[model samples]
Target: MSSTSSDIAITGANGFVGKNLRNFLHKKKINVLGISRKNFRKHASEVKITSTNLLEPKLQTKLKNYDALVHLIGTGRRSPKSMFEEINLNLTKNVIKACKNAGIKKIIFISGLGVSRSNKSDYFISKYKAEQEIINSGLDYTIFRASYIIGKTDYLTKTLSKQMKKGVIIIPG
Candidate 1:
């Protein structure tokens, strides 16, 4: 790949951090291919996106042209549509397989702040499992355990604001 080519693929590109990262990369003149489950057309028109589930069989083909993949598809809050093991662990496992198949050696994963084997929380355990998968995948990977990224409509800020309205705030360890 040449220096001027679009070499990055960002998963969950419709999310807050993903959008910010896309904008930041755009500013730096590094074009990226956005991958998300939903069709989010409200972002910069120059950025191209592929709307599909990460676990889809065609993921490797979609990723084949990219040099690296930024796996930002994990979820903290589990719902009927999204679960910890499925989104965090299974998706990550698929990503590793896709990366290997696509010949993309580099993977950048965004994990939660307190993810570890010792942490028995479902969320942390899922993240930990994802991290372990990446580590054992034999790929060049970078995992960032992000804490609270407070910005416009960020989850942490919104949660804190809701808690403040209730009169009592609980800070977990």
Candidate 2:
């Protein structure tokens, strides 16, 4: 792809981090295409936004022309094991496959920290597995693992703040 051609695709663009990233990328004059469940068209008039579930088979063809993909789709809330696997693991696999098929060169994945093979939590385990899958896919991939991101409406911060206010401290093992 030519340096002048600016085409970037971002998944989970409706989420907090994704929205912030999109804004940041836009400020740098990058042409961003967002894929999300909610419409971001009004907020980003110039940016092309598509609302679709990543699991759908149509996503492959839809993502064909993009030069790179920023995959941020994941389930953070506690849920069933299958739900985590489906969103974090299976979705990543599909995204990798789509990128490979579409000849996309680079992929930037937003992942969580503390994801390891030895981890007991399903969430972290699934993240580790997804990272492995991305590595094995042979695409140029970059993983950004964040721990307890601080945002205005961050769930972790809110929960911790509430607990602190209650004067009852409970630490996760």
Candidate 3:
């Protein structure tokens, strides 16, 4: 924040997509400031969180000077405390609020593929809600509904491997 504006600010920059995107952006000489939920501390102007909850409203003061935000804070899998809507939608709400507070426009979000208003699946519904929040927030935004990404120990791939061992490939219709 002391220097000029950053090219982009990434939420969930510690995750798989965020890591790859940051690397690609860096190669293009784009300066990135990252926000993470995991324990992250500025690593050469990248790592930027420790017990970081993007939901906190007070931190909006420090979220300034970023040209755009890449919102990657979401989950496909779920637990009791980490339900899809609870984490995904809520975090997105937080991001929108922070963006509004910081006067930051243009957020880029990667949402789940095949998610729609009529989607019956809980995961898709969660993503749809998050998307709707961004749309209604009156901020410039882009939502990318991405299909399954494959890589070493990635989320989808890991889940597929685990379920395969259980002798069931639960493909959602």
Which of the numbered candidates is closest to the native, going by highest lDDT? 1
Report the C-alpha lDDT of model 2 over 87-129, residue by residue, as the tens digit: 9999898888778877888999988988888999999988999
Instruction: Give the Cα error of residue 76 in candidate 3, in Å.
Output: 0.7
Model 1 per-residue lDDT tens digits across residues 45-140: 344556555555666666777889899897887553348888899989988888888889999999999998899788898899899999999999
- Is candidate 1 or 3 superior in TM-score? 1
Candidate 3: segments with Cα more than 4 A from true spot: 1-6, 40-43, 55-58, 80-82, 158-173
Give per-residue CA lDDT, model 3, range 56-151, as digits (tens).
654565567677899998888655434887877888898898888788888999999999999887888889999999999999999999998678
Residue pairs in steric clash, candidate 1? Answer: none
Residue-pair clashes, model 3:
1
The candidates, ranked best first by lDDT, are 1, 2, 3
- In candidate 2, position 102 carries an lDDT of 77
Residue 108 C-alpha lDDT in model 1: 97
User: TM-score for every candidate vs. truth?
Assistant: 0.83, 0.82, 0.80
Leading candidate by TM-score: 1
Clashes of each: 0, 0, 1
Q: Candidate 2, after superposition: displacement of residue 92 in Å?
A: 0.6
